[model samples]
Target: MAAYVIAYDVGTTGIKTCLIEVSGTIKLIASATEHYELHVLENGGVEQDPEDWWHAMSVTTKRVLERSGLPASSIQGISFCAQMQGLVLVDRHGVPVRRAMSYMDHRARLELKEGIANGIQIAGANVFKLLKSLAITGAVASSVKDPVWKYKWVERNEPAIFSKVYKWLDVKEYLICQCTGEFVMTQDSAFAALLYDTRKGKECFSESVCTMYGVDMTHLPRIVRSTDMVGRLTANAAAYLHLQEGTPVFGGGGDVSLIGVGAGAVEPGSTHIYSGTSGWVSTVVSRQLVDASAMIAAIVGANAGTYNYFAELETAGKCLEWVKDHLALDEINIYLEKKHVSEAYESPYESLYDYMMDAIKNVPAGSNGVIFTPWLHGNRSPFEDANARGMFFNIGLDTGKTEMIHAVLEGICYHLRWHLEAQEKKVNTSRVIRFVGGGALAPLTCQILSDILGREVETVENPHNVGAVGAAIVAAVGLGWLGKVDDAKQLIQASARYMPNMANKAVHDRNFKVFKALYKNNKKDFLLLNAGR
Candidate 1:
């Protein structure tokens, strides 16, 4: 028997609601998306209203259910795949005390310096504090964007909001509370706070870490497994979503953990790369590991007794978005002028990228000696520098916009290669990588990524919705429709495979060396120009 379920992929900028039918295989029935505001504060803070998340969820859920013609009673379960490391402090009634802080928020620089950057240091973090954090949590709050620093920032600056804080939650946890009225955090979410002890058989909040960071332990919520039935939908939430009141809600996980399941990278040593607004390279492992020097660690996995050696790039596809807005503004205007109004059914934002790809595909492998860094919002893995900014280097007088755009894509792949190499140094990464997220929609990107890494890259059907698919898999496993999360490998199949073009290896290698050196050569300048920016 097939079971119906809904998975809400709540991302940084929008919500994608997917309706799926689960049995021997997962079938996506229908889906819808709704965008929301991401308020970028002048103080380097990024936030979004919790009400916007709830509104987008309600709107997209109704749209998907309507498109599928499935009654509310037919849906068996609901779950979420959301952005991680966000801070959503809510009151006793589950209402947010202020706008939810995004994972991109880095306004806690002073707090981070005071809390972790002070005293004797290693890799720009206090040696004693780093050792204690790694011994307990297998991770450290070394970045200014880390959630603990944001928590401390609120406590110091917004004393009134902090006073009413009942429990701290991430983006999906807040939505879970909205749906079920339960104050809970999934295991991955808890570990992301860097205050959770990930030691085997002792996965919970660490009192010593909390005290060391001056974080109030009471602000943490009850931690739950990703597949556990957290609660049932409340009447108000059900009415708002046009669903049944008692629909079971499972504890879904952060995108970093669940997207790999959707990509069928479930076994230990399996690896996947996700490129969306943000990007990461994740490899499944049996035990926790940390490479403090590289700023990479094995984060708690969605499944028990599993961990993911995760390396991240804070902004990947975002660099492409920057090009679309700034470099290709004229192309967009021309594209809009040439298209008929009826053809507007297709999104101009997407079609414009397709048009840009048509232009970039002809621009040779090395972008004509140009190299761009995909650090528009700074970098995380392999280096932790909030002051780092994106730049186009080695652009000769003959270079054109097409070559620069091609370099942006190559730059993203180059950074992924950096992360892949870092992960390989510590543990064995997959020879062939599963690539997911919106970036995989482009065959050119797939081919370029394959060429840059000198490995095969595979993408599954509806690659953009892998996060939602992973959430649906979690729901299926929870409903007994699937044996376990790893069983997802039997259901999802790769739609396309991109093989590396060894012919272009030399050019890419030359560019890659320059790409890596750009940061090191300009680190001092980046600090001087972007400090406090």
Candidate 2:
């Protein structure tokens, strides 16, 4: 009988569990999903009950184990990958003191601003402090506020909870504690939390930084590497998940790092692009590279042995879904029917995208002097400004619906290109791009990306499940079934490749300049627009 490993991916929207064979083949097992609402309060506050996450993870793991029919002993180990930067506080007895704040939550904006005003420098070094200051001032919302501020917010607003809390952690650490009854943190996660010293690869928490915000480092968990087994499943947790007591549980990193490993982008200079509800561009870096201006830094990778540099476009598939629902509901079947058809040629009754692509093909690349900024959900990385809104420039009567649609697609591609360029400048490497997620299935979009970036983009066979698979790989390593993460990369198979169309390179290059200028010209306008709110 073959042994199997269970991996859980705790996402922002839901939780997914997978049972995989030691050889890296996924078995058809049960999975569970639960949705939690993002409670939005006044003044940009967002919170969710931490219990909701626990419930989702527990039920989902049990469901998968029951469906697999493997005896508890046959399961070698368990691992987890979670959304990064969300904060959870647990009291001394291990009960959540208050609702956990989601990464999207901006409730602590004022607190962060005040911290900067009072000269509360985070991470000490001038560069890190500047980044933190930028974040507090709302210059870059998502990039600036991390779990640290959330912890500080709890300290100030819920002093009772703060006094009672014994351990403060990201969502992954909190869930793992529930499983193993151990208090620990992963290096990759800690580094991304902006609470650890990334330069020395040490678990040094800044006392000055914490003191400035009235936070005590004693509440933080002991830091561990991503590959280390932090603890074992306790009898209680075993009863809850149908797993054997003492099953080893490994410390895991954030989702972005795991996603890179799952997509077979473990090697340095290899890039992975995932488009789920949101989109991300991640590449493996051997060293921590910091860019003061771009807001790009090296964070934890799938394992402690490497670093992962990530940039994000806040909305990707979400925008597409919005378009599908609002503008192309009646054309769903038509679009699906033309999946494999080349949209290069114009036909009188071509598919919706075909018409759109043709309309833009003649628009002299770059949407014919038009630029669209994709800040629909607010910018995530590179430019972390949440107040930024999407815009279209160089539009005229000649710009029809198809042209507008094409411009939107081009705008997204250009945003990604901007990140890739910035990353290359910081790291000085030419990496092949691996495109994954639901968006990768769109050949036209993939080709457009290739044309814009002047690089080949390959699609993985199982983009949607890569994160789950990567989590399983961690479990396999913990079980000693795999020697290293790279060994598990053999499991990933490329389904298709999108090579750049050189013919359109010059066209895209010329338009890229205008696309690049849109932000500079409209930055003040966006800030002014947000002031009205």
Candidate 3:
């Protein structure tokens, strides 16, 4: 017997809903994507309306069901893999008080400074506060983008809304609340807040740390496991999504926790790199660890008793998206003008990227001495600097569009390599890493990543939907269609493998040194230029 589950991947820019069929193996049936807006305020605030997320989910769910030609009753469960560390405050009725603050929102600098950056410091955090956090939760809320500061920012600035807050939820929790009319946060999502104690047998919100941060413990919600059934669909949500009123809703995790599951990196020490709009290098580990200097931490995973040593790059494929809009304007206009040509492609960006890949295929490994910094939206791992910006360094008279475009791809790979090596300093990373996400669809990217990282890069089938597939796996496990989440490793097989080419090692090595030096040399300038903006 086959069971159907719809997994919604709620991301930074949009919502992707996938209908997956589980029988002997997991298979994707139909999928639909609907984009929403990310409002970027001048004050460094990034937000999206919770209504926009609901709208996209509704539209995409109907579209997926329609395309699959399946009745709503066929779906046994619903799950989600969403962007983490976002702050979604809702009232007692489960309605958002204001626009949801994005994970990228770092407007809480003042709150961050006042809360954790004031006294004697260790790695930019107050030493006393850092020690207390480490003792209690094994991690600290060290970044401005952390949800606690955002919570404080709301408490200090928008007290009226803060007064009405019932619970603080992440992006998926908000969606889950809408689906089931229940207020709960998954264990992995709770850990992301840096307030959850992940120690064995003590997996609950840390009262000491929460108190230290001045957060009202009551604002936190009850914690549930990724595979636990939160609740059934409510009548209102069912009507909006055109589904059954009581479909079981499973507690799927965030992208960082579950994408590796879909990548088949389930065992400890298995690593996977995700290159989406934002990119990250995550490794499954048995114990929690933190490298305060590198801004890397082993976050709780969706699977029980596991953690993901995670490092992130804010803009990965987004760099290419920028290139398409800004650099390839003429090509984009041409593609749009040719209506039939555009319709022939699946994704709107696919044709443009094909043109780009073809254009830069001949460019050499190092982009002819040109190196690009992929900090278009600032960087997080290996160093935390909100003021950093992206630029192309060492462009000469001989430089061409091909070299520049190729450099962007190389720069992204370089940053990923930096993250991989940083993780290696504390934990042993996989020699042959699994690469997943829309970016892995490109053979050129896989090869470049391999050449840059000096490791074998393998990609799985339907790399773009790994997040949704992970969510589906969670649903399958919860529904008893599968025994456990690790069963996905047997179901998922590698589609392609790219081995490192040692011939290009010398050039990449030279360029990488300069790449690291670029930030060290110009960080002061970056702060000077971008501060107070």
Candidate 1 lowest-lDDT run of ten:
334-343
Residues 103-139 of candidate 2 have per-residue lDDT tens digits of 7665565566665433544332244555653333212
Number of the candidate with higher lDDT, 2 or 3:
3
Clashes of each: 0, 0, 0
Encode model 3's per-residue lDDT on 1-533: one tens digit a residue: 99999999998898999999988877899999999999999989999999999999999999999999999999999999999999999999999999999999988999999999988999999999998888778888999889999999999999999999999999999999999889999988998999998777888999988888998999899999999999999999999999999999999999998899989899899999999999999988899889999999998898877899999999999999999777764543436543445544434445668767877899999999999999987788899988998999999999988889899999999999999999999999998899999899899999999999989999999999999999999989998989999898898889999999888867899999999999999999999998866
lDDT of 1: 0.91
Reference-based lDDT, each prediction: 0.91, 0.70, 0.91
Q: Write the per-residue lDDT of candidate 1 for residues 202-318, one digit (tens) a residue.
A: 889999999999988888999999999999999999999999999999999999989998898898999999999999999999988899899999988876678989999999888
Q: Which 10 consecutive residues of model 2 have the lowest summed lDDT?
A: 133-142
Cα error of candidate 1 at position 260, Å: 0.5
Candidate 3, which segments miss by more than 4 Å at Cα? 331-350
